[model samples]
Structures are given as structure tokens and as C-alpha cells.
Target: MSRIAYVNGRYVAQRDACVNIEDRGYQFGDGIYEVVHLYDGRFIDADLHLARLERSVKEIRLGMPMPLASLKLVLAEVARRNRVSEGLLYMQVGRGVARRDHAFPNTPVPVSLVVTVRRVPPYPSSLDGWSMSAITHPDLRWARRDIKSVNLLPNVLARQAAREAGAGEAILFDPATSMVTEGAATSFWIVDAEGSIRIPPLGPTILPGCTRAAMLAEMAEHGMRAEERPFSLDELAKAREAFITSATSFVKPVLAVDGKPVGDGKPGPVARRLFEIFARHVKGAPRNALQ
Candidate 1:
């Protein structure tokens, strides 16, 4: 089947999608993006993704190309065009084309918007009790990791380091703090010995994960308290279990970090419970406000 894409104000064949070479996102990586998961032809966390899109534009001082409601409609149409019943929808808002310069482009230029859809295989039946290897990489990213910008060279290198280490993800360690901040693409979390969920607070070092927030809500129903705190590199090996959260993978278990087993090298009970709760919610979760 031919894929479809929403480029700026129009929908076009994916193979024919194109943007100006001078688009800041292409030239200087000046843009923000979000990935919304599609399940059974329904959109998951649509509101949260839109909210984050607004936040990203605000933080970067980029004018939204259209209203949030309009964008939502467009996303739904893009999904329909692509016939993506279970997959991902990606949208990026870039600073409109302008003269090449490091400083902010002229404020009045319209922001660029592009939406693309791709298929994601069904979630595995038994991803539980899985393990992943991770090596500490220096956190040298800019001070605005909170914004979902496109400047991902640092993230690219960090993930490559993790890939080279024969691991599923890269857990970054900040040089100044000597601790774990987050994974290259997913949010990091660990089940403490006392059974509390631990994650570094959202700051310049961590992207605000939409799935992470949903997991926290799911935790309350499961009687788990999610804590927003930085975890030490040494604490990884001492945790009961570890996992990651993202729109694409949902929940991924960490069997090991740096070759050390996490919680008997299996998915912990808490992580699995949360995953089950999250899965149920995603399948039939109410509107974002209810979620």
C-alpha cells in the first residue's frame, strides 16, 4: 500500500513528501516533535501529545501553525489515509524557512508542520522478565532537553554508544552529578528495594515522557507510589527491577545494566503490574483529561 503524509497544510504520498532545504529543522535542527500511538484505529493519549506539542512550541518561542483542535483532526485524517490501525503517528513543528543563522528566525514566519504514519507490530505476549544492557554515557546535551526539539546529535551518539555496548538502551550519566538522568529515547525508572518507583525529575536533562505520566497514574490504581528523584548509577544494580516507558515500546524490562542483573534478571512484579494496568488503559483509556 502507498503510504500517506501530511506535509504542512496538505496530505501527500509519503514518497513525494518534501520540505525546503532551508527549513530550520533540516538545516539547524530547530524544531519539536511528538509521536502518538494508534491502537485498533483509535488514538491513544491524543490530548497529552497535543499538550506537549503546545509546550514544545511555547518553550521554543515558535508560533503554532494551527489550532490544537485543527491539528488533532489532521492527525486523525492522516491515520485514516495511511490505514494505520496499530502503529505510530509522528508530527514535527519546525521554525518556518528563513535565512540561515543561529539566532531565532523572524517571528512572523509561519511554523512548518509535517505528520507521518507508520505501522508498529503488536505488543509482544511475554515481554515481561526481559533484560537490557546499558553503559553510562556523558550527558553533554543542551540545557533544554525538556523541549522535544530536533537537535538530536548528542542523543544519537549516546544511543549509538549503547548500541555498541550490546544493549537495548543507553542510560545517560551526567558528569556533574555522576548519576543516571534518563535513557536516550525512553524514560528511566527503577523499583527501589522498598518498592517505590524512582525516576529523575523532569528538568533540563529529561524529556517529559507522555507514557511516563500515564504510568504514574496507573501506578496509583495498582498501589504503587511513583517518586520523581534522580537515581545513582550504583543504585541500578541494587534495584528490585528496572524498566523504560515510551509511546512506541510501552514498557521494556531491563534484565541488566552494565552486565549486572537487575532483580534476578527478570521483570519485577511491580513493573509487570504497572504494564498490565497501562495496557488496559491504553486499549480503552478515557479522554486525556480523564487519563
Candidate 2:
């Protein structure tokens, strides 16, 4: 079946969807985007995703293409048209098309909105022996990593580096401080020697992740308090276990980093437990329960 996409204010065939050639998102990477996971025709952590979308748009000084309520409706309609029960919904908002120049246009143009949905495999039944490898790269992104902007050249390079190295993701760190920041496309976390969950605190260096937030809440519910603090590469080398989180990857265990085995070179207890908790949360918990 042909896919459908929401372009600007219209729903059209994906092949026919197009934006102005001068759109800021295309010309200057002046835009923000969000991806929400869908399961059984229901959106998971949608409110958090939309909230983050609003934050990103505001961070870039871009106007919302439509009101929040309207945007949600549009997302639903797009998903419905695509018949995507288990998949991802992507939305992007840009500053808008204008004449070729470095600054905002003298006359404000309506922001551009694009929404698309596609199917993906269902979540794994268990992560017992499942694991992914990662390679470390120097964090070369702009200072405003907090915003989910389309400026992802550094991320693209890092991810491609990982791919070439036979790894699934790239962990980025500050070269000078040796402090771990985040993955190119996910939030990084570790289970320290003391059995405590540790993740880098929310800051300019990391995008505040919805799945990361949900995992923390689930951990708290299970009497596990995650410490929000930066850990060095040397520290990570000796960690009991490691994992990365995102809307798509969920709580994926990191078996190795830069070709070095993590923990016992297997998915550890902490990661397994969190994965189970996260899975249950997404499957049974109400959307409002997360908020």
C-alpha cells in the first residue's frame, strides 16, 4: 500500500509530499523533530513526546505549525491512514520557507509541518541475552544539544562511524574531561559497581529523552533511585552493566563499548530488570500514568 504523509496542512501521498525549496529546514537545518512509538494502534508516551516537541520548537524560536491539540489529531490521522499499529510516528517543524539569507525574513511566514508513520517489528519478548555494541566518539555537536534540531551532521558522522565498526550506536564524550555525555541517537546509562543506576544529568550536552524519563519513573516505582551524574570513560570501563534508551531502542543493553566487553560481556541483571519494567509500562500502563 502507498504511504500517506501530512505536509503542511494537507494529507497527501508520501511520494507527492513536498516542501518549498527554500524551506529553512532544507537550507539551514533550521528545524526540530520528534519521534513517537506506537503499539497496538496506541501512542506510547505521546504526551511527553509532544511536550518535548513544544520545548524544541520554543528553543529554536520557531512558531508551532498548529496548536498542540490539532497536531495530536493530525498525528493520529496519519497513523490511521498508514495502518501502523506497531511503528513510529515522526513529526518535524521548521522556521518556514523564505528568501535565501542568513537571518529570519522581514515578514514572518507560516511554519512548515511534516508528519509520517511507518511500521516496525514488535518489541522483543526478552532482552536476556540480547545486547548491542557501541563505539565512543568526541562530542562535536553544537552547545545547544538540548534542542532536537535538524543539525545532525556530527551525529550522522558518529553513527556512520559506529556502523562501519559493526556497532549499533556511538557513545559521545567530552575529550578534555573524559566525561560521557550521551549516545549519538540515544541516552546513555550505566549500572555502577554499587548496583546504583547512573545516567548523565539533564543539561545542554544531552537531549532530555522521553524514554529515559519513563525508565527513571519505572525504576523509582521499583524502589531504584537512579543517580543523575556524569561518569567518566574510565569509570564506565569498570561498570557492572550498561544500556542506552530511546523511543525506538527502548532499554537496549550495551554489551560492549569500543570493542571492550561491558560487565561480564553479557546483558546484566539491572538492564534486564529495567527492560521488563519498561515493556510492562508501555503495554499495560495508561498514558496518563506516565505523566
Candidate 3:
């Protein structure tokens, strides 16, 4: 089936969707984006995704193209038009078109909005034979990684490096501190030797991942011990297991790092259990349960 896209104020063929060349998102990368997961024709964690989009829009000093309520409707329509029952919905908001200039336009301009959807494989029911790997790379992104902006050149480069290295993801670390920040496009987590789940604290150094937050809440609901402390490269090397989370990847186990096996080079029990918890949470967890 041909894909459909919502561009600005109208729905059009995905191939025909276009924005002004002078749009700030195209010229200066002055925009934010969100990727929402669709499962069984229902949006997973819609509240969290929209909340983060709102936060990102505010941080970038860009106006929302329309009320979030209206944006949700657009996203639903886009998904429906594409006949995507299990896929990802991508949304981007830009600071609108303007004359070539570094400064914001002297006159108000309506923000640019785009929404599209694409299909993905169904969620896995087990990690019995699944294998994924990662390689360490320097975090060369800006200090405002907290914002989900479109400035992703550094991430693109890092992910490309990982691809060339025959790895599935790039685990990024601070060059100066030798501390693990996150993956190029996913939240990084580890199961330490003592069996504690560890994720780096949220700050300017990393994006506040919606999947990470939901996973943490699920863990908490089960009375699991989770720490929000930064883990160094040395600590990661010694981890019992490692994994990466994102809207699309969900809770994926990283069986190896830098070509070395992690805890027998297999998916650990902790990761499997976490994956099960997250999968169940996505299917039917209460909205208030996502604290």
C-alpha cells in the first residue's frame, strides 16, 4: 500500500509531501520530533509521547502548530490512511518558514507540522535467540540533548560508525569523563553484577526517553531495585547484561559490546524479564502507572 503523510495543514501522498525550502527545520534544524508506537491499532503511551513533544517544543522556543489534541487526531488519521496497525508514527514540528536569517522572523509565522507512519515487525514474545551488539563512541552532541531536536548529524555519524563496525547500535560516552551517556538513538541500561538495574540520570547530557521512563515505572511497580546513577565505561565492561530501549526497538538485549560477550554473550534473565514487563505494560498498563 502507498504511504500517506500529513504535511502542514493537509494530507497527501508520502512521496508528494513537501514543505517550504525556507522552513527553519530544513535550514537551521530548529525543530523537535517524536516517534509514537502503534500496537493493535492503539497508541502506546500517547500521553507520555505528547508530553515530551510539548516539552521539546517549549525548550526550542518554537510554537506548537496546533493544540496537542488536534495533533493527535492528525496522527491517527495519518496512521489510518496508511493502514498501519503495527508501526511507528513520526511527527515533526518546525519554527515555520521565513526569509534567510539566523534570527527568528520579525513577523509571526505559523509553525510547520508533519506526520507520517511506517510499518514494523510485530513485537517479539521472547528473546530466546535474539542477538544485538553495540560499539562505544564519543558523545559529540550538543549540551541540550534533553531536547528532541532535529540536530542529529552527530548521532547520524555515530550510528554510521556502529553500522560500519558490524554492530546494531552505538553506545555513546563522554570523551572527557569516560562515562556512558546513552546510545546514539536509544536509552542505555545495564544489569550490574549485584543484580541492580542502572540507567544514567536524566540531564542535559541525554534525552529523556519515553520508553525508559515507562520501563522504570514498570520496574517500580514490581518492586524492582533501579538506580538512576551514571555508569562509567569500566562499569559497562563489567556489567552482567546490557540493553537499549526506544520507541521502535523497545527493550532489546545487547548480547555483546565491542565484539566481546556480555555475561556468556546471551540475553540475560534480567533483560528478558524486563522485556516481558515492558511488553505487558504497553499492552494494558494504566496511564497513571507511568509515573
Residues 184-288, candidate 3: write the lDDT tens digits: 999999988777889999999989999998888888899887899999999999999999999988899999999998888889988988888988987776662
User: Candidate 2: how many backbone clashes?
Assistant: 0
CA error at residue 15 for candidate 2, angstroms: 1.4
How well is each residue in 41-89 modelled by candidate 1, as lDDT tens digits?
8778877788888999999888888987788788889988988888989
Clashing pairs in 2: none
Q: What is the Cα-based lDDT of residue 74 in candidate 1?
A: 89
Winner on TM-score between 1 and 2 is 2
Off by over 4 Å in 2: 288-291
- The 0-to-1 C-alpha lDDT of every candidate, in the order given, reads 0.84, 0.91, 0.90
For every model shown, the clashing-pair count is: 3, 0, 0
The deviation in Å at residue 190 for candidate 1 is: 0.6
TM-scores of the models, in the order given: 0.94, 0.97, 0.97
Between candidates 1 and 2, the lDDT winner = 2
Displacement of residue 262 (Cα, Å) in model 3 is 1.1
